[model samples]
Target: MSHGVNNVRSRWTLPDYKPTQKYENAYRVTARFLLWVEKTKNRKVVDKLDAALRDGTYQPEMWVKLTGLTVDQLWKEYGDDPALALTYK
Candidate 1:
């Protein structure tokens, strides 16, 4: 039984997989936004974000309302933080 061979699931699980820069940037941005949300917002707002995501209703305006920051401001504040290094495969 070649369980090891069958166990392979997806390209992302491959050892040599490298995410594109766009994907990595998006991940970093989302992570930064979520961190901000956790730090500044209440649990109810987090719940709303979760629900909106689940329901396919999440929108940029929700972020603006919660963080009181526009997309440009978010990018300026968190997007270019060199500490948030991109992961390499």
Candidate 2:
């Protein structure tokens, strides 16, 4: 009977979320892609992709092929929509 708080029994706890390898991989891929574009691709390429993302018509197949990730994975990393963001690791 030396407990500090015994008012009531509860099962509540704070969430301790951590990003998995998939998330790290996605982040790295996106960072590298952006850096590559910044170095080689012009602003127009980024602008076009931004427009496509806004319109929900973005297809990152070429990026996937180069990054060795699936379209779904790229989308999870680079998708503009919140719904798609929620699909991330």
The weakest ten consecutive residues by lDDT in model 2 span 80-89
List lDDT for all candidates, in order. 0.49, 0.42
- Cα deviation at 88, candidate 1, in Å, is 21
Residues 1-89, model 2: lDDT tens digits: 12123323443221222233232455444443444343343435556667778999888664443455554554454333222111111
Q: Please give the distance, in angstroms, between residue 67's alpha carbon in candidate 2 and its true position after superposition.
A: 14
Backbone clash tally (model 1): 0
Best-fitting candidate, scored by TM-score:
1
Give the clash count for each candidate: 0, 0
Q: Per-residue lDDT for 1-89 in model 1, tens only? A: 12123234532321211222222355444544554445544335667778999999999788677667755565455435423222323
Q: Model 2 off-target regions past 4 Å? A: 1-24, 61-89
Candidate RMSDs in Å, in order, are 9.0, 15.5
